[model samples]
Target: MQYFIILTFFLYGLVFGSFFNVVGLRVPTKSLFNPKRSYCDTCERTLTWKELIPVWSFAVQKGRCRGCRQSISPLYPVMELTTGLLFAFTYYLTGFSPELMLGLLLISLIIPVTVSDIVYSRIPNRLLLFFSPFFILYRILYPLSPFYDSFIGAGFAFLLVLLIILLSKGGMGVGDLKYYTLFGFIFGFSHFLLLFFLSTLYGALAGGILMKMKKAGRKTKIPFGPYIGLAALTVFYFGEVIISWYLNLFL
Candidate 1:
């Protein structure tokens, strides 16, 4: 029964991940609702329900569009599979609770933003706007949760980032600003700080590697949103363990 429940959530995540691929692709283009259907990006043929079976259909089609036989981007199946695994991991860590559900929801929300940012260096405002209400609801309903911490996190993130943006004369984009503040609200202040620290470390490490490889220059602008998302998700799961270790050093 436990395995069955976990499998169900995994499958459910894959289904939602498939839809998230569509949202991530379309929302950036500002065409979220007009077509109201999924289609091949290359061939433009509308995909049937049978052709839309998460990772399975891609494997069945051998990762090509049925209409045009053009190679499809592997991102679709990869995102589906990744979401499925992440959801299963969340279930393992959180078991069953409102926190479990919210953790899953946060994953779903961040995936699109991360993808969009990595691909285009632009996070869709619509995606963030859509999820913001749920953050508020999470605070109201789960009053015992770290609501105050998240509030302070959001405030600190926004003002500090805004100051940096001003000093840099637009070195930071609005999307980055909004994402940092919103994630602060979602994860609470301490976890947000932890995530921010980890994100900085990740960005620095990746940048150093790229520079060393000559794949990027000192001035190359790499997207930071994806790193932030990765750090946030990691901290969400292992935050208590990480925080305790850090505190023990001083205590």
Candidate 2:
């Protein structure tokens, strides 16, 4: 029965992932509802129902658009598969608890933001605004250990990021400031601090690798939103385990 429920979540996740792809790609451009149908970005041809079956369609089409025969971006299938796995894993971890709702919400927010950041090097304010109310409502309903930690965390993150922006002078953007502050509210102070560290660590590591491969120069701008999303997901899933492991090392 457990496995069956996990499978159901995975299937539903794949479908939602498909929608998320659309939302991520369109929201940044403000064309979300203009066309009203999924169209091939390369060819601008409307995709038929058979062409929209999540990961299956990508595999059947051999990663090429039938209309233009252009190779597809591969983001579609990857996001769908990732969402499915994440949904299943979240279910396995939290079962049917309220935490499961939080987990699902986190995944939904992270996936679309990651998609937008990867594609456009921009995180739409609209996307963040859309999810902010939900997160606020969740925190209100199930306040953290001191409750005020949420507000404190958010304020701390805002000030920290603001300091960074001031000192570095173009090192980060307003989008990042908002993103980090929102996550601070979601994860509270200690965990939000962890999220910040992990995100910077990830961004640094990725930048190093890209430079080593000569894929990017020092001046090349790499989007930081994906790293932030990854760190948020990590903190959501394993922050407690990680914090405990660290504390035990000192003891």
Candidate 3:
């Protein structure tokens, strides 16, 4: 049974990873589910089913478009693999419960948001707009209250970033504020503080490292959405353990 569950998770991850590829590519352009076909960005030729089979197809085709033989970015396979691993981890952590479903949905949403923000430095309001109602519905269905927790999370996150932006003379972008507002709803007020701290810590550390290595200029802009996504995933998976660890250290 355990092995079966693992296999199920692996298969589910593979399928969802494929869908995420579409989302990552199309969501930015607002072309998701439009034109009803996948095309080579380079050659503009429609991709056949054989060319679209997620990780395996990339391997078989040697990471080149079939129509134009243009070399496709290996990032596609890497994203698919990363998403697959994340799903597998979520399944292992939550098993076959409501938490598992919620985790999957949250991770799925985060993947595209992360990619979109990293690539375009923008988080489309459409992504959050579409998912916000779902978050509310899930909270209601689960009967998790203070129904206002979601709003509180958004308000707090926005204000916190707003302060940073003001202090730094607009170091933070409005896109980040928008992203975190929706992200806060997913995390809710109960964990918002923790998530914010963790994400800010990670983002600062990462940005500092990049600056030290001279890969990023001191003033270079970096997207914050991925850090927020990472922090949310951490809280979802290990909030209790982390909180306990912190309390033990202090008390």
The clash count for each model shown is 0, 0, 0
Model 1 / residue 199 / CA error / Å? 1.1
Q: What is the descending lDDT order?
A: 2, 1, 3
Encode model 1's per-residue lDDT on 1-251: one tens digit a residue.
98988899899889988878778877898677875578888877888998999999999999988899999888889889988988888997789988797888788888888778877788899999999898779877885264587788889889877897889875668988998898888777787889889988998999999999999998999888878888988888898899999999999
Clashing pairs in 3: none
TM-scores for all candidates: the values are 0.91, 0.97, 0.90
Candidate 1 backbone collisions, by pair? none
Give lDDT tens digits, candidate 3, residues 1-251: 88788777777787787777678667878778696687888988888888878789999999999878999978678777878888888888888888987888787788888878777877777887787777777776774467777778878888988888788876677777877776677667667788888989999999999999999997788888889889888888988788888889999
Say which candidate scores most in TM-score.
2
lDDT (Cα) of model 1:
0.85
Q: Candidate 3 — worst ten consecutive residues by lDDT sum? A: 139-148
Distance (Å) between predicted and true CA of 101, model 3?
A: 1.9
Per-residue lDDT, model 3, residue 91, is 84
1 or 2, which is superior by TM-score?
Answer: 2
Q: Please state every model's RMSD to the true fold in angstroms.
A: 2.0, 1.1, 2.1
TM-score of 1: 0.91
Q: Candidate 1: misplaced stretches above 4 Å?
A: 144-147, 169-171, 211-214
